[model samples]
Target: MAENASLLVELLTEELPPKALRQLGDAFAQGLVAELRAQGFASPDAPYTAYASPRRLAVLVKEVAAQAPDREIVVKGPSVKAGLDADGRPTPALLGFARKQGVAVEALERMQDGKHEVFAYRRSERGARLAEFLTGALEAALKRLPIPKMMRWGAGDAEFVRPVRGFVALHGEAVVPCSVLGLAAGRSTLGHRFLSTGPIELVRADDYEAVLEREGKVIASFERRLERIKQGLAAAAGDAQIAADEALYTEVTALVEWPAVYEGHFDAGFLEVPQECLMLTMRQNQKYFPLVGRDGRLLNRFLLVSNMQVDDPAEIVHGNERVLRARLSDAKFFYDQDRKQPLQSLVPQLAQVVYHNKLGSQLQRVERIEALASAIAGLLNADRSLAARAARLAKADLLTGMVGEFPELQGIMGQYYARHDGEPETVAAAIEAHYRPRFAGDALPGDAVGDSVALADKLDTLIGIWGIGLAPTGDKDPFALRRAALGVLRILVEHELPLDVVELLQAAHRQFPAGTLAEATVGEVHAFMLDRLRSYLRERGFKADEIEAVLAHQPTRIDDLVPRLEAVQRFRALPEADSLAAANKRIRNILKKAEVVERAPKAELMREAAEQALFDTLLSLGPQIENHMQDRRYTEALSTLAGARNAVDRFFDEVMVMTEDAAVRDNRLALLAALDRLMNRVADISRLAA
Candidate 1:
């Protein structure tokens, strides 16, 4: 093995896609380090740093060996008995094996086999050179990159995420000779495309980042570059708040080799439009960071991340402002044109929009949503009129010019247009809030009206799509059914709505035409919803076993899942939890063979002393637990059930459950079944046994 030293590898390329740049760089570094560890050239604990920029991807690892360590080689030959004759001399088998190994028969050693001795050869094998092995490793890593599209350039038959401009691989201070993607490894790489004086020379592996930052004028670390932009934004925005957008920040970091923050402004007339419209234009069109005042509203000023710095940035700021002016003008035009039509008037235009050929037009879907929303609102005891009205107008903005330009602003534009059309505040708020919690960890609907409308909107899509057998398969959820199911689950649980999942699903299905849904459609959708519920609970910090125990009973009211999970969590902490869990499992097994749970065990039939004692204790405990349970006191009920552990243990220990007498055996089985039923009312206790 060679001495350990720092290693650096950089692949200079054309500008990478900004959004996926960080992910690609991180994956490349991770794959490279993992291969090094598996090949015995780098320790798992070795420190490493990944460097990514708009123009290059690089990784630096500390304490990487130049070659893998040599290992002892063991080669097995034929069994000793098969290789030897009656005289214990080498036979043809041994001779052939020795010849294949380039050794004589006498040089082979014999060792005991399973039923006989086996001939084996042992020797030292030199480890492969890192320079040679890394060629394949680099190729494998490139092949495994998460590039959605690979492009080819200039007729070499090599393809990559982008065209490869330069490739450098260095171990310590020496260049590890290798070729990747048809480019030979070298120690020279270019600096900034516009600002560089000449090609930057990398003398040592450790000098890669320092040389790039100083001579190349590049902040090579993605994270450090992001921090620079954040600090720069704060400095430029002063007391005003920059929009709290992590994704936007990360994207801008990937677009610049060196970052310079500058403040720009737009016409105060554009401020008449909604801030969402203006900010969306700023972010999506220009990648500019919009500033918000202390009142949580947008200021006229916006921050821009420049790739280069000049002593006089007047032209840069003026140029950005000029670009933003035309962008905002188009947005203002869309908003003004959208408001020219009443919100309700736009509803007819949706008829021309095809939602799904198998389902119906968008207008028909909206009608279903309106009906479902009113039903859900009635169940939730909210204003049904407002919910239906919100559902009616939710898709109206999809016809608007603003949404046509920026599809992400569909619900947001509906809210603006609804208010402009003089709709009720409740209805206007619901129009936008209905799409709340659009993604995981997002905020849910703002109130009961929003919740009702949101549920109806999601279920309309889910039932309509699933009825046609177009539900998500594998990762191909074109309809986002999983997201819809999770949204429904989050609404019910987070809002503490007392709606039953099955009833809601059945109600949603009823709005469809007769026979439009499969016979098992409701059941299938409910089960899928339950599956999502289990995962949602786990994400909220519940244990897997706790969630499984609660889900086993398949409670219809998802709002009650948390209470059951909490009770199970408390049950696990009890002193008798293990015994109760084991006992419940035993009771389940016994009852699995008998169906006499409803047949009351006759008091006179309990002949065994231990059985009578357990029966008497259950008489007092079951009713008390049932009383607390009727009041939804799950914790108290479970705590009360814990008191039955000693009686249960004694019953199993001293009583023969399968007495030969017919009446006694039936009564014993009945008693065990009754215990099992009471214990598992909140959750299937057997799952806790795991």
Candidate 2:
């Protein structure tokens, strides 16, 4: 097999945030592959490599075929009713279909599989060359690929993350000609914004790496950029260690066309503030990387990379320092001002800020949070006073100037203010930890008080939105309800807090119903909680049927649901579990047969040996099944059902269940019915994957 050729693409644009780069990179790669496959490109595999910087998004494909493979197509034509006339002559419909198919009218043939007459035809056509279709299709796909956010430049219609300044498209040495969003296809691409000289001509797809390298651009791969960023930051920090925030590093690497390391310092006095405040202010506000001493204490120094290289390093350092100074000053002012007032003082200010137009004010949300958290604390056996204190101040930061500018600092500032106000350590910790693991892979709440507050906050958000019918509709969950739901699951799972989620919902709803916030009722809120839980658990590696099964048990506590699900999943893995599932299905089938006559066998009249065996097995296993399920030994319960398999198969094999005597038939049916109840305690075996 000869090595397949490659195609290269580069969409040069203005600087983009590091966060947006991956999203755009993914969109382009996925869209290109999907389009090529759709256009019938079938020459081995065309794997893609993508690289992004602040200015350009680039991709290089490998092993793409020179041409598409010829494919056979089966086109379904008009039905016999529409294709045939009374005289059986080729009707206008048949002629029209042939014309639409690009086949001659005489080529039409009637295909028959069985009794039904159907109009079908098979045609083979030579596929268009890969280059030709790829060129056109790639151009079209690039224009339509969805970016999370886009901007219009040049003309109002020209919209992308940024202006489309240049495009590089090549298949082997040949330039694939097409245009998108006003940019014409070319082999020319701009390299690193400042480091590279000018627009460089990509002689061929294979030369992409060499050209960028020679031009002082690091475009071959992301590994090089990541290495340089990591090495440079570490070298600059020396004894002052620069710990990489995985997320922050990724965002910064994507935001720069050519990353150049720079370090700056703020007044040491700022270290007096909490590390969370300084880190948040630095990373969120200035996009500067933070540094720490060997002892893991916050160092007053910070490091950042500039996308552009400056002639004067000292000037660049001074400029960045100025920005840091202003930000740290503002942070200091907010911290000091917040300390002067007690945590209780901010409680009244929350009323002025509306949480949601329909959901009332933040004060009302705090009220809801307080009540729910207090109730949840009681359920979890936490200190109710601490839970209520934490909940009341959770949203107070929304009114803070610091949080207003940096919404990500909501909980961080609350914790700071709580501690500054000399609130109990538990309450302060809860304030900060309540929003733990705000997103996927985020940390779970650390303590009982924190867990309770976390649960209450997410529950309030979920129930409040659900009550108003403003629940996440499809993929449009603007409220991040999905995250809220996941947070609820994480808090429950990590804390292992035995909870009745429904009871919690009822408690929360009772405290903060539509009347409480002009929203809805407890019943409506409960339904929404169920929806959020379904979506949440499904995301956390639970199958839909597994969720349905465990949720059917409706364990009130998240702790109960987790183990029950773990048990169900454990049972699902066993060999006998499948056999038991098969038996249940067979039993249901037997019951179905008796359904039409509306009569079932009775055990009293079951004289057959197999029927007697099945009845005895069910009778013996009934209490064992109940005991295992009561102990939450779903796996054991499923194991117990394994006993019914041979007995069930034997009964089906020898006995005629639908007998003349309704009493005998119903009695046998009752035994099978008992088996279903036991098996279903583990899972609705009928819904298990076959």
Candidate 3:
């Protein structure tokens, strides 16, 4: 149990799903290493390396013990009162407890447990063997893999992402006997299915990668494979760019065990299609890295990540080119067929494509989007017809042959077709840009018309989806409503637009016919949108309580929120901020407890000098604060209100609001209520009080 040695484990299988192979490899390695550390077989500082190839998942861990050390355990039994019966003779509870611990009744000691004396048994439980614990760990790690679909092979009960081919577990040079997925563990593995020089018999734990690369013709490390691919791409592309994309690189790394880059080319006429379309075809469909010129346009050449490093790549290059030519031919066919009809002609066909059963067809959704975009354009002083036209044609491309083949090209193809239809440049740009900020950290639309349509389109989705109670729940957001909400907030707050989110929700939902979405949902949707805005503000580094203070006023204009928060922050730092905040809180409590009394304080009843002084200050500062607030200079307004701190403190110190005289008490209450309103004009600073 005290011995320690480096260990290696590998699960060699058929080719794994490339997109998720990296994630699966990491999860398996971390889960096993964590289990070993938790079971006391692995040191806290033990290092491990994860290896994922197209056919295998493996981990090499250092300093793993053969077994975990024994530990003491305390088992509690019945309380003393329950254990003793009559003359304190050994009762059934005491007898049974001693029998379970395999000790005499006299050996059971009594100890205080939770205010009661209870019998307890203490002993050392033997540590577990690594060979015994490893089977469970290996099974658990494989069971937890992120496999979208799992299948069983050869009528076996074992299930995995792919069919099991091999399972290798080694402790240094010794084989750790275990069974996984119907395969006995051993220090053996297969390399490249086609190019392996010979069978690999691993003699040592640390020689896995080296042996695989030498005799088995495979690079075992996922990272090493990525580096090899990157270096090979550089050499193959020369001075030209390889059109680098991380996702494409990762997938390619997962697809090959030994990478060798081969260059292929298609006819220059295929470049007539938009570069984005061509690039997507190569990257998404073929998994090829398209070469781009210095001007960022796709060239006729592409690079393939072939798994084999053959003596002659002439035949491989020809085969890749022949395959790519056919792919490009289909792409050109779709492009030519799509341009035959104007983009607008596709609008009538959308009526047949159901957007959602509850929301009717795509044509109906477009009508709602068109109206909302037009309204938004009016508020932004943009050309209304351009926004409307863009919204009308935005979804038309959904029916195009090009877009039907590649759904990702919906908006992009819309832009191209809009231009081909001789639409205004602004409208054409808007058609594509309306879906901007598609994901988190993505850019917002560049043009005014684009912004208008983007906001309107996202708002329509949020309002309709939220109105029908189909909003996101827990981890499930089938409609992506949360993303839609955040997009709406980013457009409003980040753009500094003064549009009221609540009003936009109302305007959007109203466009839907009766029973489509509840009219009563206006308030709920407003609160939800504000919550997204709150999260957005926190990400920008605003304090939580400060945001709460400003939001209490329900400010309609998001552009004014930051200035209001800054004004409250400035108010908190003032010399009188603490005293005024305390007095405001006290006034709020008093008003809550007091009965309905809307009457103003009588001037004749203000006899006390402290009360009179507070009133005079408020009367003088009233106009100044009002003027500053009107100009949206929130900081200046709150600064003017801070002048009342001295008077407010004095009044609280020298006067008591709950007096025996009824008339005087009402007057004091009225004065406090009036002061509270003026101080909170910008924000509810009372919430900021300590």
Model 2, global lDDT:
0.76
Count of backbone collisions within predicted model 3: 0
Minimum summed lDDT over a 10-residue window in model 1 is located at: 593-602
- Per-prediction TM-score: 0.94, 0.80, 0.93
Model 1 stretches astray by more than 4 angstroms: 1-4, 77-100, 105-107, 110-118, 595-597
- What would the per-residue lDDT of candidate 1 be over residues 1-690, giving only the tens digit for each residue? 237888789999999999998999999999898888888889989889999999999999899998888878889999987898999888998899999999998888888767777999989878778888888989888878899888899989999988999999989888889999999889999888777788988999999999998999888999999999999999999999997589999999999998999889888889999999899989988999999999999999999999987788899999999999999999999988888999899898889999988777899899999999998999889999999999999999998899999999989889989998899988999999888778878999888999999999988877878888987888899989999999998999989999998888888888888887777888889999888887888788999888989888768999888988899899999989999999999888887876564777779998888888888888989999889888889999899999998999999999988888988899999888788888888899888885
All candidates in order of lDDT, best leading: 1, 3, 2
Error of 3 at 541 (Å): 1.8
**Candidate 3 segments exceeding 4 Å error:** 231-244, 310-312, 569-583, 599-603
Compare candidates 1 and 2 on TM-score and give the better one: 1
Candidate 1: clashing pairs of residues = 80-117
Q: Cα miss at 477, model 1 (Å)?
A: 1.9
**Total backbone collisions for each predicted model:** 1, 19, 0
- Angstrom error of the Cα, residue 209, model 1: value is 1.4
Local accuracy of candidate 2 as per-residue lDDT tens digits, 184-299: 78887777666777878777798887778777565445557767888889899998877557778878787665678988888999988777778887887777889989898889
